[model samples]
Target chain A: MKLLEDRIKKDGQVLPGDVLKVDNFLNHQVDPDLMFAMGEEFARLFQDEKITKVLTVESSGIAPAILTGLQLHVPVVFARKHKSLTLVNDLYTSTVYSYTKKVSNEISISKRFLDADDRVLIIDDFLANGQAVMGLIDICEQAQAKIEGVGIVIEKTFQRGHELIAEHGIRLESLAKIAALEDGKVVFEKQNN
Target chain B: MKLLEDRIKKDGQVLPGDVLKVDNFLNHQVDPDLMFAMGEEFARLFQDEKITKVLTVESSGIAPAILTGLQLHVPVVFARKHKSLTLVNDLYTSTVYSYTKKVSNEISISKRFLDADDRVLIIDDFLANGQAVMGLIDICEQAQAKIEGVGIVIEKTFQRGHELIAEHGIRLESLAKIAALEDGKVVFEKQNN
Candidate 1:
C-alpha cells in the first residue's frame, strides 16, 4: 500500500472535476510488477474470506483483477460493457452511470458464471462515486452470491464510495486512498498502521 | 501450450457462423493458473526480443496482457475502446472493425505510455480476422515503436488473421491454432515444433 501511494504521488496528475489521472502506471499504462505486489496485498487482506470468484468491470479493472486472481489462484469474471454476439440470453444486468464518460451503460455477466454457491470479491481500479461498484454488487445480489469483500487499487476517500460500501457492511480495502488533490499534489489518507 | 490447447478443446464452444467462444476460460471468465502458464509460454517464445512493454486492446485482452507483462517484467499498456475524462488529449488512435459486433470502433493508447525507443509485444485472446491486431499494429506504427511479436492465445487457422499478420512481417505466435471448428468440434493444426 505504501508503494502504491508513493507511485501515485510521483506520477499521478490531478485535474479539475476531481479527476486523478494515473495512466502512467495504473489504468491505461500498467506497471505489472507493482500490480503483482498489490495483488499480494489483496490476498493478504482477504486471506480469511472464502473467495471463489473475482469480479470486475472491463478495461481498467482487468489488470488488477487478473493479478489478484493470480495471487489467490481463483478465477476472474469481468463484466463486458458492450453486448457481444455470443453472450447468452440469461444474464444478470445492471445499469452504471459513468461520471467520466457522462453516459449510462448496461453492464452484464452471464448467469452461467455466478450462482448462490459462490463467494465473490469485487475489484476495481478507481472508486469514485461508487456507481460502478454498486452495479457489480447489484449483479452479485441478483445471483444470490455471498459478498466476501471489495479490493480497490486507488480510492477517492473524499467521495461517497467508501461510505456506500461500508453501509452494506462489506469489508473494503484499498491500497491508496486519496484525501485530496490540491495544486497538482496528491494528499493521501494517513495510514493507521 | 498443450494445456492451453486442451482447455480450448474442452471448454471452447464453437457456435454457428465460425464463432468459437472460449469465454469460460479466456475472456469473460479467466483462469489465472492457465493465464500464468500462457504468460510463461509467451516469455519463452519472445525470449530473444527485448520487450519494453506489452500492448493489447481492452476488455478481453487485459488478463493475458497483464500476465505476460508479469513474466516479462515490463509495463502493460492497454488501448481503451472509449475515451474518458481521465484520458489525455495526445494519443495514438486506430479504427478496428469487429466482425462479431458488426461495427467499427476506435482504440487509442495514450502517447505518454508508448515511444519510439520502446519495443512492444502485442498480446490478445483470439486472432480471427486480425482486425484488432491490425489496429494495435497501426498504433505501434504511428508511435514508431518496435513490435517484437504478436502473441495470440488461439488463432483460427481457417481465418485470414495469420496471413495478414504474416504479410506484415511480424512474428506471430499462437498457443493453439485451430485448423477448423467444423460440426462443433475443434480441429487443431499440428505445431511444427
Candidate 2:
C-alpha cells in the first residue's frame, strides 16, 4: 500500500473535474510488478473470505482483477459494458453511470458465471462515485451471490464513493486513499482503510 | 497450449458469423488457472525473445497479458479502445474494424507506454481478421517499438487473420486453431502455429 501511495503521489496528474490521472502506471499502462503487489495485498487482506470469484468491470478493472484472481486462485468474471458477440443471454444486468465518460452503460454478467454458490469480491482500478462498484453489487444480488467486500487500487476520499459503499455494509479496502488532488499534487488520507 | 486447446474444445461454443464463444473460460468468465497456464505456455514459446513488454487491447486481453507479464517479469500496457479521461493526446493511435461488433473503434496507447526501446509481444483473446492485432502493431510501429511476436488464445483459421499477420513478417502463435464450425460443432485445423 505504501508503494502504491508513493507511486501515485510521484506520478499522478490532476486535471479539472477532479480527475487524478494515474494512467502512467495504473489503468492504461499497467506496471505488472506493481499490479502483482497490489493484488497480493488485496488477497492477503481478504484471504479468509473464501472468495469464489473475483468480479470487475471491463477495460480498466481487468488488470488488477486478473492479478487478484491469480493470487486468490479464483476465476474472474468481468461484467461486460457492451453486448459482446460471445456473451449469452440470461445475464444479470445493471445500469451504471460513468462520471468520467458522462454516459450510462449497461453492465451485464452471464447467469452461468455468478450464482447462489458464488462469494464475489468486487475489484476495480478506482472508486470515485461508487457507481461502478454498486452496479457490480446489484448484479451479485440479482444472482443471489454472497458479497465478499470490495477491493480498490485507489480511492478518492474527497468523493462520496467511500460513504456510498459504507452504506451497503460491505467492507472496503483501497491501497491508496487520496485526500485531494490540488495544485497538481496528490494528497493522501492519513488513515487508509 | 494443449491445456488451452482442451479447455476451448470443452467449453467453447460455435456461434453464427464465425463466432467462437469461449466466454465460459477465456474472455468474459476467465479461468485464472487456465489463463496462467496459457501465459506460462506463451512465456515458454517466446522465452528467447527477451520481451520487454507484453501488450494487448483492453476488456478481455488483460488476463493473459497480466499472467504473461508476471511470467516474463515485464510490464503490460493495454491499448484503450476509447479515449479515457486521463489518457493524453501524445498517443500512438490506430483505427480497427471489429468483425463481430460490426463497428470501427480507435485503439490507442500513450506515447509514454511504448517506445523504440520496447520489445513488445501483442497478446489477445481471439484472432479473426487480425485487424485488432494489426491496429496494435500500427500503434507499436508509430512508437517505433520492436515487435517480438503475437500470441493468440484462439484463431479462426477459416478467416484471413493468419495471412494478414504473416504478411507483417511477425511470428504468430495461436493456442487453438479452428478449422471450421459445422453443425454446431467446433473443428480445429490439423496444424497450429
Candidate 3:
C-alpha cells in the first residue's frame, strides 16, 4: 500500500474534476510487478474471508483481478462492459453510469460463471462514485452469491464511494485513497488504522 | 504448450461460425493457475528476444500480458479501447475492426509508455483475422518501437490471422493452433518437428 501511494505521488497526474491519472503504472500502462504486489496486499487483507471468486469489470480491473486471483488461488470473473457476440444469453446484467465517459453502459457476467454457492470479492482499479462497485454488487445479488468483501487499488475518499460500500456493511480495502486534489497536487488520506 | 492445447481441447467450445469460446479459462472467467502456466510458456517462447515491454489490448489480453510481464520482469502496457478523462492528449492510436462485434474502434496507448528504444512483445488471447494484432503493430510503429514478436494463446489456422502476421515478418507463437473446427470438434494443427 505504501509502495502504491509512493508511486502515485511520483507519477500520478492530477487533472481537473478530481481525476487522478495513473496511466504510467496503474491503468493504461500496467506495471505487472506492482500489480502483483497490490494483489498480495489484497490477499493479505481478505485472507480471513471465504472468497471463492474475484469479480471485476473489464479493461482496467482485469490486471489487478487476475493478479488477485493468482494470489488468492481463486478464479476471476470479469464483467464485460460491451456486449460481444460470444456472450451467452443467460447472464446477470447491470447498467452503470460512467462519470468518466458520461455514458451509461450495461455490464454483464454469464449466469454459468457465478451462483449462490460462491463468495465473491469485487475488485476494481478506481472507486470514484461507486457506480461500478454497485453494479457488481447488483450482479452478485441477482446470482444469490455471498458478498465476501471489496478490494480497491485506488479510491477517491472525498467521493461517496466509501460511504456507499460502508452502507452495505461490506469490508472495503483500498490501497491508496486520495483525500483531495488541490492545485494539481494529490493529497492522500491518512492511513486508516 | 501441451497443457494449453489440452485445455483448449477440454474446455474450449466450438461454436457455430468458427468461434472457439474458451471463456471459462482464458478470457471472461479466468483460471489464474492456467493463466500463469500460459504466461510461463510465453516467457519460454520469447526468452531469446530482447523484450523491453509487453503490449496488449485491454480487457482479455491484460491477464496473460500481466503473467508474461511477471515472467519477463518487464512492465505490461495495455492499449485502452475506451478513452477516459485522465488520458493524455499525446497518444499512439490505431483503428481496429472487430469481426465479432462488427464495430471499428480506436485503440490508443499513451505516448509516454513506449519509445524508440523499447522492444515490444505483443500478447493477446485469440488470433483470428489478425485485425487486433495489426492495430497493435501500428501503434508500435507510431511509437518507433521494435516489435520483437506476437504471442497468441489460441490461433485459428483456418483463418487468415497467421498469414497476416507472417506478412509483417514478425515471429508468431501460438500455444494451440486449430486446423479445423468440424462438427463442433477441435482439430489441432500437427506440430512440425
Q: Score the docking of each candidate (DockQ).
A: 0.89, 0.80, 0.88
* Candidate 2 chain A weakest ten by summed lDDT: A82-91
lDDT on C-alpha atoms for all candidate structures: 0.90, 0.88, 0.91
TM-score of each: 0.96, 0.94, 0.96
What's the CA error at residue B67 for candidate 3, in Å?
0.6
Can you write out model 1's per-residue Cα lDDT over B47-121, one digit (the tens) per residue?
Answer: 889999999998788888888999999999999885333444688888899898788888998888899999999
Best candidate, DockQ: 1
Query: In terms of docking quality, how is candidate 3 classified?
Result: high
> Chain A TM-score per candidate?
0.95, 0.95, 0.96
- Model 2 chain B poorest ten-residue lDDT run: B82-91
Per-residue CA lDDT of model 3 for B39-105, tens digit only, reads 9999999999889999999878989999999999998999888533345479888889999979888
Please list the residue runs of candidate 3 whose C-alpha ends up more than 4 Å from where it truly belongs after superposition.
A83-89, B82-89
Clashes of each: 0, 0, 0
Q: Is candidate 1 or candidate 2 better by lDDT?
A: 1
